[model samples]
Each structure stands twice: as structure tokens, then as C-alpha cells.
Target: MHRFVVIGGGAGGLELATRLGDAFGARRRNPQATVTLIDRNPTHIWKPLLHEVAAGSMDPYTHQLEYAAQAYWHGFEFQQGELTGIDRAAHTVTIAAVDDDTGREMLPSRSIRYDTLIIAIGSTTHFFNVPGADAHAFALDTVAEAERFRRRLIAACTRAESNDDALRAQGALPTHKRHRVQIAIVGGGATGVELSAELRNTAQVLSAYGLHGLDPRDDIGIVLIESGPRLLPALPERVSTETARLLEARAIDVRLGERVTEVAEHAVRTASGRDIPVDLTVWAAGIKAPRVLSTLDGLTVNGLGQLNVRPTLQTELDDDIFALGDCAACVWPTTGRNVPPRAQAAHQQAEFLFRAMRDRLSGRPLRAFEYRDLGSLVSLGHVTAVGNLMGGLIGGTMFIDGLFARIMYMSLYRMHIAALHGIPRMLLDTLAHWLRRRTVPRVKLH
Candidate 1:
């Protein structure tokens, strides 16, 4: 019997595990194989929508998948624990003990043996060791963190609204008569940029609902600070330029070429000595694979702490071991560039590995994974979206925006839903979610 273990139940890992389990798990009674999925969290939330979670535009609880329930219905064994180490010689992975929210021990450390192992633990925020950055800035890596940020944002606005005189005296007024709650966001990547835009929409929605006393238009100040010259540096220059223009038109302060040297309690200090007052500071700067990657029992890791893998998605040192998603540094064979860590990439890799696993079980030749550049999309809240889609006259990417781009952007999440829960569940859930949204507040206030 082959014991297949997949660690880290992120998008790629969860999908792969569900498919593999459905194929070989007890429902089918395939005595030749067993599948298990291990993750620290009891539920799974799509990483891409985290910014929406942080900005209170979306409630994560409504979208999260209960791993235990998913496993029961889909035929995979689910284990909850943090990955601590891997034993290459014995083909075993060690999971650290976990405690409940009250600090009571729930489970002890254990090791699981596997004939085949897939590691996709995902990445964490890389603070770059900036002074006070880790201590003062909020990183949206988990649901809890996102919810915390949302609460802080609301609290900041509420406090500012209640103390207009103090704000006016402190020169926190955006204009002659209104005070703005200044939010400092570090990094102009998709998370930072999207959150900035979403927050603007959140302010408007909050104000219209009378959730706060301040004027949304005049009381919310957004300062997006990017060390780079423009936003979404990973994307095309045109996209970045248009995005900047859109942000500026919405009264957002896009500060380019200003590196944050320190994140203080109430402000962010830039490289050029400019101090930006901040009611809330969010650090969406950069990411690195979890530090546990470095301790993964002789696995070779790149500078980003990602496991080095061949095009086959097999770890360089061990064929029995494989990796995918943000944790794997797999170079695109055609472009000689490492695959960019994107949700699209993760989704594609999951599909590729699903087929690869079946072949391995049948002792067939495994095909190498090829990454496709499907272009990128950036959503500007409910207003619009901008992105470049593949398929043009010369086979180059074509820039797109407005209503069409928004539809395309939405389709991405719909696709992820379809991948995870199948078309029927995805469709039903979509309708249910739409109905629920009409009855609830547009943004989460608590």
C-alpha cells in the first residue's frame, strides 16, 4: 500500500489532496493507496481574497472550507498540526503539537510516514528586518490577522471621528473642515494595491450605513508607499501607470520611490526623511516561505526559503519528495525564470500534479510541468478592474479594464470555487452568497 501525504492545505495542496483522495481513498476502496492532508488551520481560505478580508469587504468565515468536513465528504484523512521537520531517510514528516485557543494542549507531536510526500506549506510575510516593522505593522497572512486589521481600521476611524477637535489641532485634517484617518500601506504589490482600493470603497460603504460619523470622502486618507517607482512592479508598466492614475483620482496618496525605513507606532519613516502619519499601518511588502522550510531535513532551499524543485516538481535531492505552490521554486523551462508565486500558478500546478500522481501510481512516465503566463488582473474594489489577458494579434498580452476586466477578475474566484467544490456546489454557493450579501452590510463593521 502506498501512503501519500500532502502537507499544507492551501489552494494547491487542498485541491490535490481532495482529488487524490476521491480517486484512491476508502470510498473507492483502492487498497493500493491512502491519502492524507495536513494543515495547521482547521479551515482553508483562498489566499488571494485575504486583502478583501483585511479591508472588511469580505467575511472570511463565510468563505472558509472546514478541512474536517471536506475530508469526510471527499475521502481524505485530515490532520491539524504545524509542520516542524521532515525525515528524508525514513520518508517521514514531523508535525508539532498544537494547543487550543486557551493554551491548553490538544495534541502531542507526531510523525507520519509516507511513500510519497507533497509539501506546499505556502509563504509568510518577509519583514526584511526593518526596525519596528514587525512590531508595528499588520500582515494579512491569516484570517485572524485580517480580521484584526479590519477591527483596527474601524477603531481608528471611530476614534478619529469622535475627536474631530483633537484631529484638527494635530493637523490631521485632509481639508479645511474635515479630518482624515491616515492609513499607511507599505508595498504596492497586488495585496497592498488592492487593499488600498478596497479600503476606499469600505470607507464609503461604512459612511453610507452610518457606521461611523466621519465623512468617507474627506475623512479617509490612504497613503500607499512603494520603494519601487510604481505599483504592481510584477505587472506591466501600463497596468501600473493606469492603476496609479485610478488611485490618485480616488484621492489616494500614492507615494513612489519612498522606502520605509521604520514603522513607528503612529507613523512610517521614509528613506528620504519624510514622515507619514498613520492611524493604521499595514505591511504587505514581501514574502518568504515559512522558516520551517530551512529546517526541512536536507531539502535544498532558494534564497526565499522555497524548496528547490525540478520541472517535474520533484525536490532536487529526493524523488520520493515533491513540492508545489508558493513553497516550491520551480523554474519555467522555456523562460528560464522561476515561476511567479500566484494563485493562478498554484491552481495550474494543482491540476498538473493531479494527473502526475495518477501516472506515478501506474508506473508511467511523469510529464514535466510547464507554466503558462496567463497575464494578471488587479481589482479596484467594486468600481472596476485592470489587467492584461493573453491572446492578441501577435500572441502578446492585451490590456483590459472596466466592466469586462471586472467580470474576468470575478471568474477567477468562480473558477477556484469550481475547482474545489465542483460545479454544482460552486453554483449553489455562489447564489447563496449573493443572496446573503443583499441582506447584510456591505462591509464588516465588527
Candidate 2:
């Protein structure tokens, strides 16, 4: 049997591994391939929902899927380790040792040999070398990071209210004046925009829970700063305009064309010499492939540290090695640019690779990948979303918003679930989550 090793249990990686395992691994009557998935974390959560986690609108425990359970059900081996190095010549990948929370070793370092290797280790936040950014700002790259941000946000709100109460008692603050807790999000992309909207709702929920004394709308200030002239530059201008309008209506301060020069402990300094005071700061400016990609022996990575792959999703110099998702820089012939690093792009690439891998196993030719532009969507809280639907079916680009767009935005996550399990399980999971929501607080108070 051929050995298939996939590094990274991300959205694209997990989906591809599941498909391959179901089709060719031990689950099949006549197994042809032994599939293995390697990831640093023991569980998987959709990257798009990290913002919601940070805002405390979603309970991560309920949504996170255990990698070990997935592998058991799909007939694949799950390895919890970080990719340390790749040896293309030996066809072996080195995994670093894993440690428990108490610093005890859980798994020792080892190398896994593979007949075919797939690299899907996704991107990390790019701070662009801003002064103090790495030390002062938070990035929503993982569940742990998102949880940290949520805790900090809660603490900040509580501390601000406490300070105000003391000042009022001493007659230093007037009764009419409210203490402001400002949060600065350093990006106007989907993550920052969605997070800002979710935080607005979070403030309201926290007030309703009686966790803070300050008024939700009047005291909680969310500022979204973007260096670009408009938000969501990847989308059309109309969508950006509407998203900006919606956010501004919610009292979110949208600052466009202002580049961040420095991040202080309690403030963000802009290129225009504006110093915005903040209680908490989140960096969602951009993303680059993990630094480990650059250390890969003899792999040709692009400027973004992504492996450069051909149209067939194989590395330029190695036929046995393949890459997908945000970590792979694959060209789009239609625009003469690399495919956009979006979940939709990754899903399409994974589907393409599933068929390509089947052909490779059967000694057949692999076809080139053709990416279809499916447009984009940006969520504005739970009630509304803004995006354009593109394709021949829609007869070009049709803009949508409000509740209908919100439903469409949600269906994307459902589709990911259906890809892993079947449509039936996805439906059950949806119903279960909906029922659970009725019992839980709108935002995590603790």
C-alpha cells in the first residue's frame, strides 16, 4: 500500500485527508493507501470562525472537531505534532516533539516516510514589522489565541467600569460622563470587519448579563483601521462601501487609508500622526505562510513563504510533493495572479486534488487546476452580511445583503461540515447547535 502523509489538519487539509481516507484507505474494502494527518493541535476549527470565538459569540468547545475521532471514523492515522522539517530526497518529514501543559513530553520527535506528501500548513498573522506589534497586539490564528483575546476583552471592560465607579465615588468623574473602553482592530479585511460587528453585539450581551457597569453602546468603542482606501479590497467597491456604511451605522469607527506605524501597550499610532488610545488591540492586517516553510530543504517558496506549485498543484521541482490552501502559491491564468488565499479557493483546490490523486494512483494523467471565481461575502453580525454572487448561473455579479446573505454566509460552514461527515450528520449538528444556543448566553460572560 502507498503511504500518504498530509501535514496540517486545517480546513483544506482535513477535508482532503477525509476524502482520500474514505476512498483509498482502510475504510475501503480493498485498501490501496495508508493515510495519515499531522497537525500541531489535537482538534480542528474553521479558521473563518476564529473572529466569532474572539468576540465570545460562539462556544468553541461545541464546534471544535477532535482529530483523533475524525481519523478513527475515516480510517486515517492522526499524528499530533508540528512539522519541523521536510526531506524531499528521503521522502520523509520530520515532526517535533509535543509537550503537555505542565511541560512534560507527550510524544517524541519522529520522521514519517511517505510515498506522496501534501503540505497544507496554513498562514499566520503578518505584523509588517510595526514597532511593538508582536508584543502588544493579539492575532486570531488559533483557538487559544482567540480565547486569550476574549478573556482580555472581558477583563478590560470590567476594569474600566471599576475605575469609573471609583472615580464617581470620589467626585472626580461626573455622573453624566461614561468611561470608554476602546478596542483597535488593525485591519479592514473580513476578520477585522466581522470581529468589530461581533464585538458590538458582545458588548450588548455583557451589559445584559450585568457583567459591566458601563453602557454597551456608549462606552464600548470599536475602531477599525485600514491602510487601504477602502475595506475588503479583494471585493468590489460597492460591497466595500456598503460594509463601511453598515459598520459606521453601528457606531464602529472605520478609518481608511491610515497605516499603522507603531503599536503601544495602550494605543496605536498611525502614519498620519494620529495616536488612537486603545484598551485592547487586535492585528488582522495580513497573513504570510508559517516561517517553517522557508526552512523546508530545497523547496522553492514565493515571497509570501508559500511553496510555488504548478497548475496541477505539484511543486515545481518535485512531482511526488503536492500543496494546497493558503500555503501554496498557485497561479490563476484568468488574472495572471496567484489564486486568492480564501476558504473557497482552498475548497476548490482540495476537490481538484482529490480527483488528481485518484488518477495518480491509477497511473493516469493529472489535469491542470481551473479556479472559478465564486465572489466573496463579509458578515456584519448575526443578522446581516454583504457580498456578491458571481458566475454564469447568476448572470454575472449580483450583490446581496441582509438576512438572506447571512444565511448564505452560514451555509459555507455547513458545506464544510458536509464535506467531512455526510449531509445527514451536518443537519443533525446544525439542529443540535441551534438548540444549544437557546439555552446559552448570547456572549460568554466569564
Candidate 3:
């Protein structure tokens, strides 16, 4: 029997493992392949939702997938470990041991051999070596990190409200002079834009709960700083312009073409030597493949540490090894551009690899990967959404907004759920989520 091991239980990796297990690992009597999935974390959550989680607009636990349970249900073996290194000559991967809460070793370091190896170990936040960025700015890269940011946001709001109460008691000024809480987000990408909007809604929700003394609309300030001339540089120019308009209408301070030179303890310093004081700072500027990729035992990688893969998504030097998602640097031949690291791109790659791996097992040729631009959507909490749809009925890209675009934006995540848990489970999960929201606070308090 062929042994297949996939490292990383991210969006692309988890979906690939699920499909492969359903087909080959489901039947024990005549199994075509022994599928195993390895991940550092015990659970999986969609990476894009990290922004919502950070803003406390969404509870992550409801959407998290337990790797052990998912693996059992889908007929795949789950191994909890992190990749230490890969031995291309030996066709094996080294998994480092995991420690328990008390720092005791729970799992011993081991090596797993594979006939077919797929490396979908996703990317990490790239700080660009900006001074003080790594220390002062909060990054939403994992569940723990997002939760930490949410806590800080809650604390900042509470502190500001208390300060306002003290000022009022001393008759410093009228209620019109509201206490202000400032947040500085560095980046104009979807994560930064969406997070800013979500944070605004979060402040409103807190005010409604009597957690803050000042009016949310007047006192909560969000400043988005982008080095580029516009936000959402990857999307259409119109989308960026309209997004900027909407954000400004909500009173968000949008600073463009202002590069952040450094991040201080309580502020963001821009290129013009302007020190914008902020109570909370978040960095969502850029991404690069995990540092482990660069030391992958001679695997050629780009400057960003992404593995150089062929059109077939296979590593340059190894035919049996494949990669995708944020870690693999695959080119879009049509546009002569590296495929953008978007959820849609990851979904497309996973779908292609699903067929490609099956073909490999059956002694057939694998086809090349193609990145389809299904357009992009930036969701402004629940007020509205903006994006374009590719190859619409009008024969070209059709720009859309409002309710229609919101539905389209949501369907992207639903599609990912379907790929992992099937349509029936995905629908049930969605319904449950909707019902749960009605009974809980709009935003997490603690």
C-alpha cells in the first residue's frame, strides 16, 4: 500500500487530506493508500476569519475543526506535531516532539516515510524588519494571537471609558468632549480594512452593553495606514476607491501613501516623521512562507521563503513531493504573475491536486494548475460588501455591491466548508451559527 502524508492542516492541506481519505482510506479491506495528516495545532480555523476573531465580532470556537475528530470521520490518521525537516533522499519527514502544559514531553520526535508527500504548510506574518513592529504590533496569525488582540481591544476601550468618567466627575468638560480610543492598523489589504470596520462595530456593541461611557461613533477612532496609494491594491481600483469612501463615511481615518517607518510603544511613526499616537496597534502588512521552508534540505525557495514549484505543483527537484497554498510559489502563465495568495486560489489548487493525486495513483499523467480570478470581495461588517465577479452574464468582470455582493462573499466560505465537511454538514453548521448569534452578544465581552 502507498503511504501518503500531508504536512499542515490548513485550508488547502486539510481539504486535500479529507478528499484523499474519503476515496482511498475510507475502506480498510482494500485501501489504495494510507493517508495521514500532520499539524502543529489540534484544531483548524479558516485563516481569513482571523480578522473577525481579532475584532471580537466572531467566536472562533464555533467554527474550529477538531483535527482528531475530522480525521476519524474522514478516514485519515491524525498526527499532532510540527515539521522539523524533510529528507528528500530518504522520502521522509521529521516531526518534532510536542510538550504538555507542564513542559513535559508528551510525544517523542519521529520520522514518517511517504510515497507521496504534499507540503501545504501555510505562510506567516512578514514584519519586513520594521523596527519595533514585531514587538509592539499585534498580528492575527493564529487563534491564540487573535484572542490576545481581542483582549487588548477590550481593555483599551474599558480604560478609555474609565478615563472619561474621571474627567466628567472633575467637570473638565461637557459630554461633547468624549473620551477617545485610538487604534492604528498598518496595512491597506482586505484584512486591515475589514478589521477596521469590524472594530468600529465592536465599539458600538460595547457601548450598547454599557461597557463604555462615551458614544462609540464619536469616541472610537480607527486609523488605517497604507504604504501604497490605495487600499486593497490587489483588487480593482474602483473597489479601493469605494471602500475608502465607505470607511471614511464611517469616520475611519484612512491614511494612504504613508509608509510606516517604525512602531513605537504607544504609536506608529510614519515616513513624514509623524507620530500617530494609538492605544492599540495591529500589523497586517504582508506575508511570507514559514521559515522552515528555507531550510528544507536544499529545496529552492524564493526570497520570501516560498518553495519553487512547477506548473504541476510539484517541487523542482522532487517529483513525488508537491506543494500549494501560501507556501508554494506557482506562476500564473497567462498573466506572467505568481498566483496571488488568496482563499480562492488555495481552493482552486486543492481541487486540482485532488484530481492530480488520484491520477498519480492510477498511473496517469497529472494536469497543470490554473488560477481563475473569481474576483474579490471586501466585507464591511454587515453594512455592505464590494467586489467584482469574473466572466459574468455581461461577458466581463461585473462589479457588485450591497446584499448581492455580501451573499457572494459568504458563499466563498461555504464553498470551503462543503469541500471539507460536505454540503449537508456545511448547511447544518451555517444554520446553527445563525441561530446561535441570536442568543449571544454581538461581540465577545471577555
Worst 10 residues of 3 by lDDT: 173-182
- For 228-342, candidate 1 gives per-residue lDDT tens digits of 9899999999999999999998889999999999999998999999988888899999999999988878889999999999988999999999999999999987778899999
Model 3, 248-289: lDDT tens per residue?
A: 988899999999999998989999889998888999999999
Off by over 4 Å in 2: 174-179
TM-score of 2: 0.98
Best candidate (score: lDDT): 2
Q: What overall lDDT, based on C-alpha atoms, would model 2 receive against the true structure? A: 0.94
| Tens-place lDDT digits, model 2, residues 99-218 | 999999999999999999999999999998999999999999999999999999999999988887899899897555423799999999999999999999999999888999878888
Off by over 4 Å in 3: 26-29, 171-179, 392-395
* Top candidate (TM-score): 2
The alpha-carbon deviation from the true structure for residue 439 of candidate 2, after best TM-score superposition, in angstroms, is 0.7
Clashing pairs in 2: none
